[model samples]
Target: MAPELPFDDQEASTNLPLATQIFRFVVTGVGSGILDFGLTAILQYALGMPAGFAKAIGFVCGTTTAYIFNRRWTFRAEPSMARFVAVAVLYCVTFVVNVGVYTYLSHLWPETVLYSLLGYVIAQGLATIINFIVQRTVIFNIK
Candidate 1:
C-alpha cells in the first residue's frame, strides 16, 4: 500500500486560481532570483570563478529554494517521492537549458555588467516559464 500523506487527497489538490498561482510564482521567483544573482555575482566577480560554474552554483541554490516554496505555498501539496523525482528530472532539463543559454549569451555579448544581467534575465525567464508549466500541469496536478 502507498504511504498516507499528511494532508487528505482533497487538501492535496492545487485549486488556486491561475492568476493567484502566477502571482505567487512571480513572488517566489523574484526571491529565488535575488539569491541566484547575488551568489553568481559574488562568485564570478569577487572570487574570479568562471561564469558558467558560478551560474551553475547559483542556479542550484535558487531552484532548491523555489522547489520548497513552490511545493508548499504555491501548490499546497503534500510531499510525495514520485512528485519529488519528477521535479528533479524537470529541473535537470532546465538546468542544462538555463546554463547553456546564459553561457552562450554571455559569450556573444560584449563583456559588460548590463549585458551579463540581461543574459541572466533571459535565461531565468525561460527556465521559469518552463518550470511553471510543467509543475502546474504534470508534477503538481493532483487532479
Candidate 2:
C-alpha cells in the first residue's frame, strides 16, 4: 500500500503515465539545458574562465535543476537520502559521458559556433537517454 500523505492530493506526487513522464522530462531537461548553456557562456566568455571549469559549473547547475524538478514532477517520488545519492552518482557518470563527447567532437571539428552547438546536442542527447532509463527503471522505481 502507498504510504499515507499528510497533505492534499495536489501536494502528493503519484507515479505518472509513461507518456506524461516523457513529456515532463523533456520539458524539465530543456529548461535546465538553457540555464546550463547560459551559465557556461557567461563564465567562459564574460569571465574569461577556462572552458572545462565553466562547463563543470554549468553542468552542476543544470543537473541540480533537473533533479529538483524530476523528483517532484517527473517521477513523483518522495525524497530520500538513498535516492539523492543514487542521482548524484548517476550525474557523475553522465557528466563524464557528456563532456567527453563534446570534447572529442570539438577536437574533430574546427572550433566554430555550429560545431560547438552540435557537440553539445549530441552529448546532451546521450546523457538524457541514460538519465531517463536509469532514473525510471532504477532510482525512482519505488515511486
Candidate 3:
C-alpha cells in the first residue's frame, strides 16, 4: 500500500476567507516581485544581458519563491507531486505570456530604467492575476 500524504485528510474546501487569501497572496507577490525586479535589473543593466533573457530568469526565480510561500502559508497545503506538476504547467503558460508582453513593451519604449520598470510591471501584473486565480480555483483547491 502507498503511504498516506499529509494533506490527504484536508477538507475539500479551502476554509480561509477569499479576502484573507488575496491579502496573503498580495504580500507574497510583493516579496517575489522584489526578487524578480532586482534580478532583472542586475542582469539587464549591470551584466548587459538581453532584456528578455534577464526577465525570463527573474520570472523563474520569482515564481519559485511564490510557489514555496503560496503552498505553505497562503494555501496551507502539504507538498505533493501532482500539485507541483499542475503549477509547473500553469507557470509555463504564464511564462510565455509574461515574456511576450515584456518583449513587446521593450520594443516600443526607449532603453531606459523607466521603460524597463514599466514593462516589468505590466507583464508581472498580468501573470500575477492569472496565477492567483488558477491557484485558488484549481491547483491549490483541496479537492
Report the lDDT tens digits of candidate 1 across residue range 1-143. Answer: 22233233445448878886788788889999999989988888889888899999999999999999888777777898899899999999999999999989989998666887999999999999999999999999743
Q: In the order shown, what is each candidate's alpha-carbon RMSD? A: 6.0, 4.8, 6.5
Candidate 3 residues 1-143, lDDT tens each?
A: 23223234444335667886788788889999999999999999999999999999999999999898788767767777889899999999999999889989999999788899999999999999999999999999644
Off by over 4 Å in 2: 1-11
lDDT of 2: 0.80
Instruction: For residue 69, give model 1's deviation from the true position in Å.
Output: 0.3
In candidate 1, list every pair of residues with a backbone clash: none
| lDDT of candidate model 1 versus the reference | 0.86
Between which residue pairs do clashes occur in model 3?
none
Which pairs clash inside model 2?
A: none
Estimate, for each residue in 1-143, the C-alpha lDDT of model 2 and write its tens digit: 23222222555354667887788889889999998878877876688876667777888899899998888777788898888889989999999998788778767887555776787789889999999999998999753
How much lDDT does candidate 3 score? 0.86
Error of 3 at 106 (Å): 0.5
Candidate 2: worst-modelled 10 consecutive residues by lDDT:
1-10
For candidate 3, what's the RMSD?
A: 6.5
Please give the RMSD of candidate 1 to the true structure.
6.0
Show where candidate 3 strays beyond 4 Å.
1-13
